[model samples]
Target: MKISPLRSVRVTRYVTPLREGGSLPAIVEADDGFLYVQKFRGAGQGPKALIAELIGGELARFLGLRIPEIVFSDLDPALSRLEPDEEIQDLLRASGGLNLGVHYLSGSSTFDPVVNDVDALTASRVVWLDCLITNVDRTARNTNLLIWNRELWLIDHGASLYFHHSWENWEEQSVRPFAQVKDHVLLPYASRLEEVDAEYRALLTPEVFRELADLVPDEWLDDPASQRDVYAKFLTSRLAHSSVFVNAALYARNALV
Candidate 1:
């Protein structure tokens, strides 16, 4: 939970852009010989993106996916500081990193969707996980899925877990009910749903949740009353509907029989 200060990091001469989203993501090699650096473009939406990165990455790991190492980075904003909007700067400063480092993934790119698409089985599980976390990022258009080195890798969690009360709900909305997720992409992986739920429930301990909450900057949690109110609502909603999600996912996995 406690991340040490990064004294230094190595970068390879070779670095390339990975996507065309609001954030200009790239893959680069680190001094540690690690490939891929998912840098934050200060110009991108701002605090929300950073929170998305944290929540999505954490949940992905909790779901037992093979995610890469993620760390908070400090970058010189001038290199790619966020937009010049005053409101945006406040969000950028609140977020520890708006420039500097990049996210690391293993491969170059996935060439074929049919052959390279993440297996339906895995995708199904991913979908269910997304649903439980109330993520809205994974769409047919921006799957944010990459197939590198002949394996499926998920990136750009910045859009998921939107239901998280990490920041003011600029969109101010309630989480969608779990029972309503039958149409989710992970519907196909429903067969493994219950198991996934058990795994998820196990991971949402108070300590872990608090640690995650801590990682989020205080500025983001400025509206203490709204934040607490929203957190309670979101958490309660998740637990209340968790059974449906669990049962449906398990039934898909045949755990119900």
Candidate 2:
């Protein structure tokens, strides 16, 4: 369905602080009256986290995965005046501008692979996406996979593309074997990784890579088009040799079995 990027929505109210997180993300209601798990720019990770969320989530949706809709949410500084908590107050004030939000799943539960097994295709597609993006967060302890109405939805991709954290010479790092794949929650179940790799290689052409990388806001990159070009180059390079990671996954699964 070609889900696009950066649909802007103003945050109307902050329902509560998800204090569990160090960065102080929250459940907020937007002007559209839909609840979102918004990531604030004031947090330590700042826009980099939102940048990952947007690019990663959008790519997943494009590849036929059920990811929550992400939006550019505007936060009004005055709205934080109502909250008495000092820490949250500081965070709200710091995040008075545009923050990122992932549409909340109202009645969802964390995916427990042991209780509910994932089918081979879905598992393979997810593993493929995670490896391509270099997302290291989707491990057994923090699967970051959710199930709503018995359907799986991916969330919390703020950790993908960790190479961008230090872009000193990113090109050299992009195609490095995604060392963390061994811990991926879906790796063992993704027995069809090679089959999905062939299918996705055709879909994730250079045009698609540019389309997704361009979605990153210019402010996030010193040279928007140049960085986009880099992003495309890095991703296409990985996709070109995707079998390296697929082969690694096959070896991992074989060892486990």
Candidate 3:
């Protein structure tokens, strides 16, 4: 488990607020370049949210999905000069401090909530991955997805599986049905059921599983027995239904790719 050192960043000026995440995320210019700085919030879920941003984002990258660059840093609260409405400022302070940027969504904010212009085929691929990873987010309301510059980008994985680990149990770990895969904004361009199944089977290699487990932060894996048990249960459960979800995705995208 290697931790990357936080780089020293200098903010030139702040860009307008994006949206109010549990914490208010902002766009800021750093000495090196532009990056999203998410100030830490002090709520009960803040730590969990940060963990999801780090671990889940990295795992998605490992599984060959398109994700944004992410890192951890502390904002020198003094540098931020945003004058939010009094209520908003109080909420901001309650959140922790000034920060900028989060998972980046390229281009304008238009293709929000989910990816657009995708057919069933493409939707299958997205659904298969989401199902396997137990991504409970990406629903219609808070879809947590975006498309920019004609490429799909996933954001706000904080609501995914591992974030709520404490409340999870082995018995509750099962693949949810992908009946709505095709209509899912992020999964509209799905592959046919057959192809999606094959791809899912091919991608869930034991090595990939092990590596993904390894990326879990030491704090989460802090206890060897607990970590091993959790990973073992997670992998076994996910692998058990890989074919079903994968096939569903492929079936959706039968005509294309």
- Which candidate achieves the best TM-score against the true structure? 2
All candidates: TM-score: 0.65, 0.95, 0.67
Q: Where is the poorest 10-residue window by lDDT in model 1?
A: 1-10
Residue 113 in candidate 1, Cα distance off native in Å: 5.6
Pick by TM-score: 1 or 2, better one: 2
In candidate 2, what are the lDDT values of residues 1-257, reduced to their tens digit?
34375689999998987775577789999999899998998887888887788888999999999998898888998987999998888888988877889899999999987887799999999999999899989988989999998998999999998877877677677666787888998887898888899889877787787888888877666788877788788888888878877787787778876
- What is every candidate's alpha-carbon RMSD to the true fold? 6.3, 1.5, 5.3
TM-score of predicted structure 3 = 0.67
Model 2 residue 39 lDDT score: 95
Q: Which ranges in model 2 have alpha carbons more than 4 Å from their true place?
A: 1-3
Residue-level lDDT of model 3, residues 157-212, one tens digit each, is 66555525674564455554555454455554443545765766765565555555
In model 1, where do residues sit more than 4 Å from their true spots?
Answer: 1-19, 27-35, 39-41, 78-102, 106-108, 111-113, 117-121, 164-175, 178-186, 219-237, 244-257
Q: How close is candidate 1 to the true structure, as a TM-score?
A: 0.65
Q: Order candidates by TM-score, high to low.
A: 2, 3, 1
Best by the lDDT measure: 2
> For candidate 1, lDDT tens digit of each residue in 1-257?
33222234543333555457656555555556666555554546655565666655655665567555566544433322534555434434443343334356544473334445455557656866666666666555455666656666666667655655345552333333444344343454345555656666765654444444455544445564555455445544564467765665555445323
Error of 2 at 22 (Å): 2.5
For candidate 2, list the clashing residue pairs, or say none: none
Candidate order by lDDT, decreasing, is 2, 3, 1
